[model samples]
Target: MASDSLHSTVHQQPSPNLTSFPIILKFEEVVYKVKPDHRGLCRGRSSWSSTEKTILNGITGMVFPGSIKRRTGFVAQDDVLYPHLTVSETLIFTALLRLPNSLTNNDKIAHAERVITELGLTRCRNSIVGGALIRGISGGEKKRVSIGQEMLINPSLLLLDEPTSGLDSTTAQRILTTIKGVARGGRTVVTTIHQPSSRLYHMFDKVVVLSEGRCIYNGPASAAMEYFSSIGFSTSITLNPADFLLDLANGIAPDPEHASEQSEGLEQERKLTREALISAYDKNIAPKLKLEISNSRMDIYSFNKHASSRNDPTKAEQWCTSWWYQFKVLLQRGLKERRYEAFNRLRIFQVISVAFLGGLLWWHTPESHIQDRVALLFFFSVFWGFYPLYNAVFTFPQERRMLIKERSSGMYRLSSYFMARTIGDLPLELALPTAFVFIIYWMGGLKPHPVTFILSLLVVLYSVLVSQSLGLAFGAILMEIKQATTLASVTTLVFLIAGGYYVQQIPPFIAWLKYLSYSYYCYKLLLGVQYDEEDYYECSNGVLCRVEDFGPIKSMGLNQLWVDVLMMALMLVGYRLVAYLALRRVR
Candidate 1:
């Protein structure tokens, strides 16, 4: 059989000089399955019950020693990177977070620099890894950056999922050449490619072709055409070997002798051809591969034990850096990533425009216009309430994919990430509100007391935090941007209506909701800051009336100022706790 010849050739080939830590990857009877449609709609069923869909059925093979997941570097097809970060910054952060703590910061950075040079990214090292919205690095450079991230750990085995995908032929060739260089460094590189060109196909030492979740061919790339030809699937035209193999895998062959067939017949022929190829592989190749695996001295378990005894760097602790260190790095990264969004001109314009509009409308009204003053204060509560809510709502959803990728790689503790994210945004979140309060409070001319203005600023800032917390909670709980924003919209509207501004005499059944609204407390506190219970204002009839006797002010007195502050504080902590817990549940 052709398998015997292929096996002999493979065994007779001389081993190249490998590095100290060469990894050989082997698998036997690896069965992988998943439920494709959880709702069972694919099977014409309305229930949630679903059947298992086999993706890899009894897959068996090996790449020269074996591979451990921890020691294996994986680069996903899509590059999930912070658009704001430069290529150097991206690799540096990854190295700091992913490398073992045994190494010093300088050593980690040095390693990153080496990887940058090795990956030919020195020229564009400072260029940002841009996303859909931003234009930064080229596609090839981004892919290399993704690879360089994995290379930071110096993995023995590197697994890349379509690393060359979406690149042109020249760029794809360069990427493959880089990977080949990596493989030459005693690392086993396994990648999945689709319809590679002839030049690309020849670069691979070994190739495995699968048909309907079954191995149709598992041998050297150079010998693939010969093996197929021996199995009555030869081609005369000088087609790319990868293309030919793909055609064979799809149950088609380039044969001028055969006539053009109908669609139905072609499908049946393809099925039959696939079955024949699978059967041939089972009979010819499976036995030899199984025997080789059985004869291997170092199995996966023994290799792992040996690796553990050696105290390999790849098998280091789950978290490489301390919580504080992680927090510090992530905090810096978050600040850099969000600086543009936080301080953008458009956002600044929106806040300043609204602040000035409110200032101009209220424009230093006298103390006699208590109602207008109260309206302005309520507007402050409502504006700050939803503004931060909408802005913070997109936080978790936007970073969800990036979080999942990094966390799965065990980059940092979720606590550090959560803390850094929320805390780093504090200054940015408060900046606009601080400016708004300063502008409107001075322009509206309500309560000329210095202490009163300071108190109002403090309350507005406090309200900003509470509103941002609630938005974060919604975002973390529902990691869908549209859904979270919608929920936030509904929630803020409810709080606005129930904040006791437009309606003072809320029904007893729903009066409890006002207590739940942070805006209600903030509004009451602003009024308390402006006037005392005994302070009098001229009514519409020129009668002097106690300021606290107004309907809204009377109902919400200053006696519960401490209670209101306490509630706001509780909400500040409570919502954040909810957000953190919800984030924990994310996979």
Candidate 2:
């Protein structure tokens, strides 16, 4: 599918933020629904939401695009998220993801700068990106940065879940002013709001009242009081519109004698007002948007061979300037993703500590107890398995929003991202863990053979890949971080026990679990490397080394080299594929 498709239903207007012109977005009979099974259960609800009833199954709304008012804003936290990224990179990523290539880097930078100026974040342009871009910038500016990201796409339509959350009244007003400015620029911005105070109530261009899933009113905020008045209901000036709307939709308590008449009057007016407003807007406003506006990019280089009026730096003759040139645009971005991983740093420290501790444990191990071998198995299982289980709970959700946006926009394919991430991280795994394996094996005086040392490193790297894959898989299905984390813990335990750490031979009842234990292959692989390639028995004497293969189908296995390589390869591919497919949800 193409990244963007525009409908002819585009309308233009102006708002308080601008004196000239802006865009307005309107929805006609739009409806949203969820399956009955997925409906929320915590409203003390015994019966699920009905599967039928078209009117109660969905919500319909309309509003000016991109314009948020002081009292009516979306529910978004105003916090910076990345400290390592410069203000430039954050915008660049958004522009790259949303804006077309027609908008060159210079255009993007300029546009972002304009937004930066508007949001009062110009001074922090070079600020490091961190959680919410917070260190050098204020929370309000960070919220504006998010607004800027949305603006870079030049969307005439904006949908915000919540915009005024976590901000003081002054900051909230400033943000609302910026949103109003967007609407004045000709965009439709719709936001869902909780009950807002009286001061904030008058800022909205329109008030859309919803009860349960039904739309009761969709019209001007000013006429809201009068609209209810005609139905013989009085609205207080101090009453929040949202709360008043809730009461109107739910109705007053049923007094058996007057209940029927009250219900009849309310239902008739509700139906009449809803239909009347829907028609007024649908016929007049919605119909006005029935025009097409195709935005295009200007070829700048040819217009100016030298940097005169246009500041185009690209050469016209350069193949990179050709149309339909689909190649990676931001090398620095890809580098950043590949350059540093929290896991990598942690892995390095882990390797060093393990190497030192292991060395001491197996020191002079010709007389060492069987505990050394047992401890090694336990350590590897805990280390490798623990990561996947824990990360599986968080990795997906944390990256879920950004991942879905980028993936949906066709920035890159899921397979490509997976492959690039895998390739990019493998070298890190090799480098970070190699020293640890070397220090431990040599200090512990285990197998010091060169081939065996290298193979051990390979095992660590492969194990890492498997773990990352599991992380992606977990993210795909779980909605909450806690659920995923708990599940991951259980899964890790199962893998560890089934991995031959607790018992070499499996009871028939849980015998099938052996196949799922990645450590089963890892133990075998490390043993094979030490057994055949290194002089392990001679070096460690009888103490540190484990002697046998930890597998049910030991006789059925192929050559140790082929068998281990094949298993590692298959597990890597298997989990990665599962992760890749899971990643498709990101799209």
Q: What's each prediction's TM-score? A: 0.92, 0.67
Clashing pairs in 1: 24-65, 24-66, 25-66
Total residue pair clashes for candidate 1: 3
lDDT of 2 by residue, 1-587 (tens): 00011223322321222122123343445566554563565766755656644444333333422121211223234343445667767776655544444556666566666666666767777775556423456667677777776665555455565577777878877777676665555455666666655556666677776654555565677777676665456643456665665556554321224344576786765565456544544554344333211110122233223335543222222222223222244334545643546456576676677678877877744423334644563465457645544544565576566555555434454555555544544555456455656666566655556876777677766676676666657766674687777777787778777776567667889887877767666666655554432222322544534233323223223244676668767877877687677666554
Tell me the spans in candidate 1 whose CA falls farther than 4 Å from its real position: 1-22, 34-52, 65-70, 297-302, 312-316, 540-542
CA lDDT, every model vs. true structure: 0.83, 0.55
Compose the digit string of candidate 1's lDDT tens values, residues 108-224: 788788888888999999988899999999999999999989877766778889988899999999999888776766567788989988998888888889877788888888888
* 10 residues in a row with least lDDT, candidate 2: 291-300
RMSD of each: 4.6, 9.5
Please give the RMSD of candidate 2 to the true structure: 9.5
Q: How many residue pairs clash per model?
A: 3, 31
Candidate 2 TM-score, true structure as reference: 0.67
Give candidate 2 misplaced runs (Cα > 4 Å).
Answer: 1-26, 29-86, 126-138, 194-203, 209-351, 367-382, 385-393, 405-412, 416-431, 477-480, 498-502, 505-513, 533-558
Judged by TM-score, which candidate is best?
Answer: 1
